[model samples]
Target chain A: MSARILLVEDDEKLGRQIVEHLTEAGLEASWLRDGGTALGLAPQNWALLILDLMLPGAHGLDVLKRWRSQCDVPVLVLSAKQDASVKVRALELGADDYMTKPFWPEELVARVQARLRRPVLARADRVECGAIALDVAARRVFVGGAEVELTKVEFELLQALAMRPGAAIARSWLVQNVLPPERDGTERTLDVHVSRLRKKLGTAGAQLTTVWGIGYKLKSEDVA
Target chain B: MRLATRLALTLLVTALPLTVGLVFLRERAARSAELDALVDYARGRMESGGREACEDAPEIFQDPPFRLPGDRRFGGPAPRDPLGLGRGPGGPGPDGPNAPAGAGGARPLRGRGPDFQQPPGRAEPAGPAAARFELWAYNPDFRSDNPAAPALEPALRAALERGAVLASGTFELPGRNGLPPRGGLQAVLRMAWTDGPCAIVLARRIDLPAEGSLLLARFGLPALLATLLVLVTLFAFLPFVRRVRALTAGVRRSAASGYVDPVGASGSDELTELGRAFDTAGAQVREQIERLERRERSLRAFVENTTHDVMLPLTVLQGHLVALERRAAANEVPDPSRVREAQEEAHYLGALLENLGAAARLEADELPIERHRMSLNRLIERAVGRQTTIARGKGVELVHALPGEEVEVEADVTLFERAVSNLVHNAVRYGREGGHVAVVLEVEGDEFVVRVLDDGPGVSDEELARLHERSYRTESARRRHPTGTGLGLSIAKEVCERHGFGFQLRRAEVGGLEAILRGPRAKPGGGNRSTA
Candidate 1:
């Protein structure tokens, strides 16, 4: 089935142009001008949310926050203001990516497609790397067939790094993925949690080696 | 206080006391002189009587009718001539055997009864009114023989013995021997007689002068009235002085503090004039400040609006250029024609943004230029290079007929580049589509001239006159190519003005528009550095 997308924009001409482009790109996209209308729609039905920062009823940042509160749908924000702070703010508030205005139609479509494709390949409800089996659907984990207690955030950190097994992810990407937008957790918090996770997983956690100048990556041999 | 009021107050304060004191002193001197005159009159009368007693003894004996014992009138014993009678064994006797006896066998005087008294040794009676005398005189001899006479005080006697005249002072005479008590004026006249120097003091009570008494009676009331008048005048004038001083100080303070004009009028005086001047000056300053502030605010608003509007278009243009560059790089055999078109558009975009920025800076007076000596030939060569690609694309040739030697002139590098670039761009836009354009740089005497010659249709006189006006595009040029914002010549003109160069537009030798930039040559021995 075609993926369901929500496009929120205020300008009628720009919004119509974007919708036509997305439809041609083979995505089932619906256009909403106001944030209230987009918020009323059920999040379970939509695969991706394309938001414009300068909306009428509510700001795109607020809409993205409200959407993330109810569902885990990925969000892409479009803005006319090209300042770097605006892009960082939208990304911090649960948006998966940001694009400045007067952008190419193809690039906008590509970014939206990337956000939509993220959940399917997000790892089978639970992921296993080395002797560590993370049951994401059940919110539990096992280290070498022995049950291990993992906090929600600790599991999220392991899951984010484990998704790209054997590949180093930047520290910034891990913070963006594992922490809520309003949380004031630091890089030290991530390190402390990783250390705790190492103690819990024992030999399995040892397989999570640190990559200098980069971030931690799981070893292929450790995956079962 | 006002200067005038203060001056008047000072004059009044000093003049009032001096004038009143002068008047009081004059009146006191006049009254004292009058008293002295009265004393002199009494002294003259006493001195005349003393002279007669000392010079003539018979004058005292034969002055009036005598009631004596042998006067051939009343069958009494002949009266002894006391003046002719010699001193007896002891002294002169008060009553002798030949002494004139009146009723009751008492001695009588020549003038009247013996009871008619005289101031002892001073026997002369100048007037017929001897009873009117209030004088009292005493000698020890007279007082001892005449038991009815009163004696003088020892203090008075001692003062008389010292040859002091007018020794008598104000005192009450005791009423004795049937005399009435009276207040008197006193005088002591010293006379040199046969008995030697003696003081005949006479006490007479004179009535006080009416004028002196009246003056004394009114002195307190007039002084009290004068004091009250002074107080009333001061009380009335003090508020005026205080109010005037406050107004003066307020005006002075306002003048000292920046541009705060004094409020309200302070009477119709010099202070009012000063206040008016202050108001005028303050108004002028306020007006100037307000005008400057308004200019600054408008300039800021213009800058903000220009930046906002221009940056939006610039951002879109940049994105387009980036995409075009990506496409050009990806092609195995990049289409040179398309690449040239893209680059031209990008160049146009960059030039447009630069001109807008420069115009905004000029309007805001924020851009400062750095000037240096530059070779005009090199500057022209660089300007030609900027348009070489476009000229080649259009199948046009750009010829540089510059002198072999450098022609140095003073100019800012970036501004000179922009000016030359604008001229080249204008020539490329309006020149014949495939015609040749020649740039020439040469020095003539003290001037360096740069000329851009095109082969397009030449402009009319009117068009050439208004050529450098901002956004003034020729009708033919706009119809043929409407891409430019028509600010090239205007910007070039501004740069020339900034560098103190002269700009002239005329028909080219090759039958198109020609722009000439001329200015003073750099000093000899100066290195020619490229400004652009």
Candidate 2:
């Protein structure tokens, strides 16, 4: 199946080249040279939309806001500016992801392919990350095949890491979001919880990996 | 306190004492003048009237008036006044030799019994009359015959002994201060009696009002003067107070506006001078703010120009790389010209990014450089290697040589490489088409010099001098590289400065610009001799 992608960009050369990249990656892509045409995009007709913020007519964010209220197409917002607030504002307006401009053209094609191939998020009773499995409704964790008992803090920490299996979560984020406020949610305490969870997972403990300077990622060696 | 009120109080404080003192002093002077006038009046009355009375009744001069045998007042409280001041020295003028004693017995009583105080133009009889002084007579022996006479006053005795015509003295009556006016003066005069030179005297007490009341009464005028003076001065200082108040408000307003407005000054006075000073200071502050704004504008322009310069080439190069990647993935040979163009753009972008990154890091100066003893030979090799593909794409032959020995210098290796790379890039980019670009690293005259030299079409002598100035570019430079950000040389200079090295540009005899980085003398290692 050919993944249909939409691109809104004003820079003629960059837009043309991005189209070539997406096409060479085996995706059917269409490009719009003006932001004004971005408003008419029907999410059902496209798998993903790559939007550029600095455009010739209507602003990219306005298009994003309008399209998002009516549709659920994944959009990757693009900008040449390195300003963080602009990125934050784009994210807040319902952009699924972002890429700062002047990136390798191959990287954009890869991001587009990855975005199209992403699994849709849905509520499920069972969650699996490599050798670890979670029974969400029962709040139970199983390593390989046998169940491993964990404390409340340890269980929450494992759940946070296993939710996004290979992506590294920042230590500060774990301290603020995953750790209970009453427990000393400092990074030092987080390390203790993670280590305890790793130990308790026993044979599949290798999947609970510590990402240095960040928090942790749960990935079994054979999963990739 | 308010300034006006404080100043008025000062006026009151200073003027009141002086006013009171002046009033008391003036009152005292007037009182003494009146006392002297009373004494003179006593002297005149004795000379004009009392002298004649004494001669007409010479028996009354005998210290006791000779009374007739049937006289009613034969032994009255007469001639026995203990302290010898007349019955009342300042009493009625009739308290003297009785007319009955003078005329009823031995002598013919004349209207001259003792009409001493008779008015100057009146032919009055020897009857009751008002007197300002007491009248008495003295014998040649300094004796008084009047019943009310003081007994032979010392002033009269002294006059008798000296044979002077007249004498006068002042005395405080013993018992008169409370019920009556205090103090009196007596005057004695020598007169021609029918028998001998008899002396007649006049005495009077000077009635002066109570000193406390006199001084208190005089106080009103000086107090009024002082009050009036304070009022006048307060009014006079009104303008001064007003100007100072306005000055305070003006300063606060100027400060509130960030000193953008000038403080107002109108009149030529101290307060105006103060206002002018504030204005000058405020103007300086405004000028500094404007200067900062100008600098910020230039900085912003620098960022915009840099962004435009770097982005266009960056976008085009990314397209080329993607095309090449796709062609390789499809197992097709990439076009050589496109490959060469991509390499050239990559070299250009890499050098520009290095220069910009170094410039930014140098400005922040947060992380101190980690300088290791590194080889300058390695630095030159990398710089030439990085630019070799771009040089080849332009048909330029790039030649580089380092000393046969390892030439080591203490430097942060990364920053030093960026500096050397920019020099090589500029030479390759701006040198004449297909011209030779040579980079040499060698020790010359105790310093290690890294040189990037190119062929003709370099900067002129005048332009070479200006190359040290930040963001300076020549006309030929603009033609060769139209999108130059003009930051490469300045960044190189900053990096060199951070390493305590010298950077210079010169026109070589070979007819091209030579960029030089002078470093410390190379240290020999591995038994290789550094070029001397």
The chain A TM-scores for the candidates, taken one by one, are 0.53, 0.64
lDDT (0-100) at residue A130 of candidate 1?
Answer: 74
Q: Which stretches of candidate 2 lie over 4 Å from their true place?
A: A1-224, B1-222, B228-287, B325-340, B353-399, B404-419, B428-437, B454-532
Native contacts matched by each model: 0.00, 0.00
Which residue window of length 10 is worst by lDDT in model 1 chain A? A114-123
Residue A141 CA error for candidate 2 (Å)?
Answer: 75
Q: Give one digit per residue, the lDDT tens place, for model 1 in B1-532.
A: 7655675676568656755775577556633433343344334433434223312332222111233333422112222223231221111232432222222322222232331333321222221111112333333221212243235556655686675554554445556466555333344444333142123434332322232344444354445555666667677777666766776676667657655655445567776776677678777877777767766875676566556645654566676667667876886555566555555565565555555555544444544555666556655655666576667776666655544345777766546766887787777756766776766665667987777777777787667766655431222112223333256677788778877899887877558788899889888776533231
- Let me know the DockQ for model 2: 0.01
Please tell me the TM-score of chain A for candidate 1: 0.53
A129: Cα error in model 1, Å: 72
DockQ-based CAPRI category assigned to the predicted complex of candidate 1? incorrect
Candidate 1 interface RMSD, angstroms, 1 decimal? 23.2
Residue A168 lDDT (model 1) = 54
lDDT: worst 10-residue window of model 1 chain B: B124-133
Find the candidate with the highest TM-score and give its number: 1
lDDT scores in order: 0.58, 0.64
